[model samples]
Target chain A: MAAPASFLFKGKFLPLVLLLPQLIITGVFFFWPAFQAVYQSFLREDAFGLSSQFVGFENFTDVLSDPTWLQSFGRTIFFSTAVAGLALSVALFLAVQADKQIRASTTFKTMLIWPYAVAPAVAAVLWLFMFHPNIGLFGRMLNAAGIPWDYKLNGDQAMLLVIIASAWKQVSYNFIFFLAGLQAIPRSVLEAAAIDGAKPMRRFWTVVFPLLSPTAFFLLVVNLTYAFFDTFGVIHSITQGGPGKATETLIYRVYTDGVMNLNLGTSAAQSVILMIMVIALTMVQFRFIERKVHY
Target chain B: MLEKRSLWPYLWLGIGVLIFAFPIYITVIGSTHDISTIGRGDVPLLPGGHGVENYSAAWAGGAGRFTTTPAAVMLVNSLLMAVLIAAGKIAISLTSAYAVVFFRFPFRMLAFWLIFITLMLPVEVRIIPTFQVMVNLDMTNSMAGLVVPLIASATATLLFRQFFLTIPPEYVEAAKIDGAGPMRFFKDVVLPLSVTNIAALFVILFIYGWNQYLWPLLIVNDRSLETIVVGLTKMIGTGDAQNEWNVIMATAVMALLPPVAVVVLMQRWFIKGLVETEK
Candidate 1:
């Protein structure tokens, strides 16, 4: 960890005053809300919010026992895995190409990176426009070829559409990180491998891949977090977790239950579950960092 | 670097570029065509003559069948929200980081950890309660509601602290010898030195604030407070045949331009900010 500066200003109230805005915002917005989610998880209330009873872990039990919630949890894992896998592999491939001693590499990088600016919802719209089944170009082509290809009606198709859209939006971010990772690899190591009769592909596998593992692992955690939480916009815009809950993930279920259905107790329980998942992911990342330091 | 004369790199890169660019290409081309043309489902590769007409219709409003706010109003609201969020985050993070690094105070570690813990609690996981907090504060549908709660950034504060720690103790000693106060030293020495970090951070945060979806969607039912990202998705509605594909595509294009322009234009700083803040 980075240390504080050795020499410091001697101020009592000034430091507290300086820290107040962030503290207050964090207290009221971040901590309080998070605490509320945890608190509400244990309480069951009427739909009208008229009365509530403290049921220790009943809400958690209810959420855990619900087959739909279990399926959503399983679906979240599958969806997040697909998104992270596709995004990471595509970005790694493109980053490898960009890392080459080729012409117009900067131009290629610029083009690849601009998609990072597209909002997840906007990204969904672009993909939806392309695959909208009626007003879509590829969607029209698929139908004309006698393939049944309406995502709105088909569950698997809707799942595939969301995965593509979400991964497409993420490739740029992973590309940036992967490119930086590739560039950071020492040239001397690659040169030494080349002198030992290693071909480009072999060098990449033996020398480069291992060197980039730290980044690859880092991107994996980041991408999973993104797929879990950040893809809400993509799902919201394309399919509101529809076609009989085919595309619904844990995050989507929480929104549907809490905001749309007003099942506060169950929704709060799910939120607590997701919060634990995030904390777990973060701790895993920190542990990896610690291991890297030891190495 | 080992150099090889080959088309393999170019070929792979060309294909990658196409995959990344095709959706946007379709969006741009579709925006230029009329509703009937796009609705027919097989949009042409080239731009159509209805570009100005589609853009103007979407810009002014009433192009689509849905009851809607104008693209112009939503764009302005998004800009205001984005600016406030970026500026607010930078301001608060800078001051708080400055305090933690410069001064010795009681409960300093406690204050720092409180800020740090927020990194785990994204607005996504805590949506309902945050909305409840907003409702309780009477901040719903206001600009403050959209901006303030989101501005307390752990990453930004940590980044600033990381940067601040690198400032030489000699500089602080000299400032102290010259009888400079903490605020004065910060304004003169710290702020000027932090320009690059701030500019880079502004690029990331601006895009963040501009692209916010679920939060704005929940809190701002008011048409006047609609942000472009949420507004653009709303424009698409349920994807029925009666929708105005041309106008919707045009608004999507308009919504994308500012943040994309910022990223493309400030490519260097954006990359630096992104990599640094994540670290």
Candidate 2:
């Protein structure tokens, strides 16, 4: 959106004064730290945090070549894909049902949407309490049924646990968006499809699904970003990149390498990489929104 | 959209609602039971007599195995943090958006772009560097450290700017004709017109702030300043058999209450703000 050109107030200093607080906070907290991350990514610090030397692209190259980092990268893709796929599909189903003429639709919506208020960390804790091997009901039930299911000891189980917790919390958010998208579709289109003798499932795939693509695509970007960045608390509180780094995503690795292991240069490089990804995703989102506006 | 008499929608909704309710229902029920009942791996679907005791114990002081803090303190800290962040973000964004939309100035677009770029630098990406910045500023272990850095909101600013641009030029002309100064016009005209947007944004931002985990986890080492969201996880420590599951569940209930209440009570505004801002 462009700034208004016609009716305007004339004040040079007042406008700047008004803009100062936001600019200051953004500069100090955002731009400065981002610059520091980029700068530190190029320098290598000693073990004692004493002296540093210019390492140029060595840190990025080393992080890129590291097997553990590469594995973490792959795991992040798997984790995010699983989360987005599960959350989006489950939410779509629920939203479609809720969109129907049903009893207590608002109640159903509220019940489903309240989980959106739950913190990722809290969501993790809830799932952990339910799935802990020794005390959890489901955990004991699994063991009793001849399967071992300790997330603490098993990497794959831990991955599955975090995925469930993360996706579970995210479904509420996607549900709201999907429901909105579904409601936005005109009834005439659906009626026409039904008059053409298309079944409910067939009509959905042929008409409604295509109409909802923009919303689904938007949610895909958002869910990927959520899985990539916002699930840090889920990973940290539940798994902490545990069971030999199996649950470690890119964000978790950045934390473990930097704060836990004190590997500053590599962590900074990873941060820069994450920054680039966020910028790219954000640009895609904005461009898509611009296209939607045109339509 | 046309299936009115069919029972299929009801059936599907029943199952969906049940699935959504199960976890929270379990947590609430578990919180009511004695620790031994849950510890024995018996899932108690019914309420027990220890509900009050467990909540009281958790509220007075957390009952984790390794570390403990007062839940009351954490909840208060979370409330304050959420309010400050929401208010702080709204206040700054309103002014800045006012400046950008109403007043002509050099570098105005520069300022707007600077704020917008922060959309990319989420706290997760710049953890170490930002933490180091906090340390260098001696802002660690303080409430300002928890709230201030998070207050400069790009999405809020953009939302307000978008809304502000829609303000009729006739209003500005009328205010100018009446000799109303900028601040006077802002106080008399802009604020009133933006109440619904502000309220909607407050609901969304309050939840965003209250549910913050990593930033509070990183900067606030002091137990007193720990937010409920972060503290509740700390209460679970290692999630072992020795931990007090009842107290943790009680704390979880308490932690989720305020934001859930806000969203439910302000459902209209929350949905409006969420749908609008995301666009």
Candidate 3:
């Protein structure tokens, strides 16, 4: 894969020159900081940056023993699962509906896809507006209906709100992929199932669902990654991991610990852990998931 | 074609559309109302007569009392950040991809993998250390500080590599036979062919740049350098007290419009680019 059998440029210096800008930027911004994170994880540093001491694996041990850190890890897993599950199912449902030939299908597609363009922060703000207990439309209606929906005070409600908002932003992306996957299926296969007297529901379960598994699985990983790292803005703007840290994910904890609290060692350890998780997840995506995906 | 037609599809599509559109519709309507009306705890579902007043207030004077940076400055900052990040990513990625794909050089694969590894290190994970580096470099509160570090990822380069790999070797051969240098062939031949991919990437990257919250929030303490997305979030305050819902909603609308318009206008390219790039 590195060297394809193609006519190539002969000058060695030109290629180096061409790659210089990216290499320089990556070296300074990517490699340097990543190295710093790894190095700092093992060293305990004061907030004022006046003193430091080498403490091997102490920060990691501290993070592992910390209840809040462990809770955040568990919460991040739960959050990612909920986000990926909700976003995938909703998107797949809509994609299946949109796959049918109907009037204004294009219009529905257009409406559904625009939210992908909305920033996560903005998405949070929009949802917050509708869900604000006092002045929000749904919040008022929910309270009127006596369901007692106040995300601000209720932990579960706060989690649900952030989940819904994050999942809402992701649904559009999942929908596009599912639609593409659905369209890629050969019509003949569905027709064969239809002729054999398979009902639409049964056909979907056995034939369509199995065929769409690759896309579904692909989206599951993507959505999980999004929920893990990309939903920071949603969590930040909506709950700020508030109501007593109910919505705090690993990424948000990293931010709060490092930037807000100035616990450099713990945050650096968390950063290293987060980096490993992402690398592991990305490897799964590239190695296992890509191999299984048919197309 | 043999399937029976039912109202089920329409019902599902209608529900889906409604669920997605309701927030945006309500946001628009809310933006058109006065703060007093919105603050009364029961927002009208219809557009109110205060659209111009609310939007102009948000545009010129900013929203909440705490955030005095107007929407105009924030919008400009967001636009500049988005455009520069998009353009910068594309430019560097294109050249780097060209080098990796077209030339056989030492450590070529090593360079490619080095860049590829950065994908795993999102700015969020290494936020503290990266911030430390920025401070050491004295890059905080500048556009370069905001844009450069974020563009170090290899997604765009990988996308360009994927696109470049599909171009027939004959193009290179033809250009070579005609005495065209690598740069010339890249400029005249390869660049033209990659236009659609670039446009599609522009839409995605523009949104990515515009939506950046955490990095900007950390790096730029100067209110003047705030992007609209971050500025809008700051405008919300901790609670409803002294918070202008009308102006906030209007700012949300303003924040969302440009990217949404780009996606809607370039729907085809955006979709194509998204599907292809993810591969």
Candidate 4:
């Protein structure tokens, strides 16, 4: 969307001019911080904010080589992908199903949003109880059903539990977006598909699903970013990346490193690498998904 | 040929709602239980005999914790800081968005992209440098340190500007014709007319501000300076000493009230905001 030449410089300067103070604040606070992180990633450090060897890429290598670091990075990627992929699929499925309902729409809508209204910490703690296995509703139900499940004993089980919990919280958010997307599709198009003898599965696959691709793609990137970084609270409450390094993620590593270990330099370097991966992935999404995104 | 109505849809919707709403039910049930009952995992559906006990424990605990340490202070502090930051954000975003969407200016496109770019640069990547700024300002452990950095949310500005763009700027022109200054014009004409958007924006900002734990965790490590989110973490406690589940749930329930209030009170406006942007 190129700016029209008629509107380019004519009477546009005033708005742009007014936005300058905001730009300055953002530049100093946002741009400067990002630049500094990248720059610091290259520097050497020790006790008392001291060092100047300019190690260039050595930090990246050293950070990656550590077994704890490598394992955590892999786990972080898995955690994020699982959360995002599962959440997106379920949300899309629910949205499609809900859109077909002539009755119970308002009830479903209200119930769906109620979970999201709960604060993150509260939701996480609540889940911790449900997944407790000793004294949770799910625990009791599973016990009654004669299926014994414990996330504490098995790291793999813990990972799956966290993923499920994260996805459960996020599915509502994605449903909100997907519901909006579903509503945006013209009702006439669906009616036409029905008249054309498209079966339920066929109509969804050929028409509604394709039409929702833009929204799905948008959510894919957003969900990935969120699951990767923003889920520390859930992790902190549920497992604290515990039962060994099984649940440890990059963001958790950053928190433990920067806050607990007080190794600001190493943490900052990790943050820099994490940022680069995110940016590169986002750029790829822009380059490819932007073109592939169906309107 | 097919009807849009389907029994399958309603069945699925009902189940999905159950899956989503189950956690809250668990929390509310947990809150109404006694410590022994909660620990026993015997928290049942209806309000148990422990409702008064739990609520009183949380309130009494609040006074004890607030005086002896920072948890109570943190809650009050978080409220104060979040409210201030929220107000600043609305003011800053409104003025800035109005400037760009309603006014003519050079590098207008550049300003818009700059806003978008902030959305690009993940704050995880930028935390150290931001903390560095705070440290340099000698604002560490201060309420100002907890806030000032957040006054520039790109997402909020973009949302505000998008809504502002649809505000029929002929009103601004008419106000101008009546010799209204920019400030007066914005205060009297634009803002009053956009109460719905403003309310929606407030809810969004308040939740974001309230739920923020990471930044608060990083900058304000002192227990005395903790927000409710960070304070909640402290309840889990040290090695060998088991955390009190009933009290924790009580705190969690309390922490949750603000966001719930925000959502319920402004739900109509919030849906309107979404509807407007979707259009």
Give the top-scoring candidate (DockQ): 3
* Model 3 chain A worst lDDT window (10 residues): A1-10
Q: What TM-score would each prediction reach against the true structure?
A: 0.98, 0.98, 0.97, 0.88
lDDT of 1 by residue, B1-279 (tens): 476778988998899889989999999999998888887776889999999998888888756464578899999999999999999999999999999998888999999999998989999999888889999999999999999999999999999999998998778878989999899999999999999999999999999999999899998999988998999889877777568888899999999999999999999999999999988
Could you arrange the candidates by lDDT from highest to lowest? 1, 2, 3, 4
Winner on TM-score between 2 and 3 is: 2
lDDT (Cα, tens digit) per residue for candidate 3, span A1-295: 5444458878899999989999999999888999999999999977688999999999999999999899999999998999999999999999999998788888889989999999988898889989999888899999999999888889999999999999999999999999999999999999999999999899999999999988887788889889998899998888889889999999999999998999999999999999999998899888855676654
Residue lDDT tens for model 2, A62-142: 999999889999999999999999999999998998888877889889988988988898888888877889877688889
Chain B of model 4: TM-score? 0.83
Q: Highest lDDT among the candidates is held by which one?
A: 1
What residue runs in model 2 are displaced by over 4 Å at the alpha carbon? Answer: A1-6, B63-67
C-alpha RMSD over true interface residues, model 4: 3.7
Model 2 RMSD, rounded to 1 decimal: 1.5
Candidate 3 C-alpha error for residue A53, in Å: 0.6
lDDT, residue A260, candidate 3: 90
**Could you tell me which 10 consecutive residues in candidate 3 chain B have the lowest summed lDDT?**
B61-70
Look at candidate 3 and give me any clashing residue pairs: none
Find the 10 residues in a row with the least total lDDT in model 1 chain B: B59-68
Pairs that clash in candidate 2: none
At residue B220, give the lDDT of candidate 4. 86
lDDT per model, in order? Answer: 0.92, 0.91, 0.90, 0.72
Cα lDDT of model 4 by residue, A1-295, tens digit: 2333332223544565567667777887788878777777788776766665587888778898988899898888889999999999988988888777477676677667655555555566768778777667786677779977766666886787778877887787788889988999998898899988888899889998999888888788878887887788777767777767678899888878876776766777898888787877678667665576453
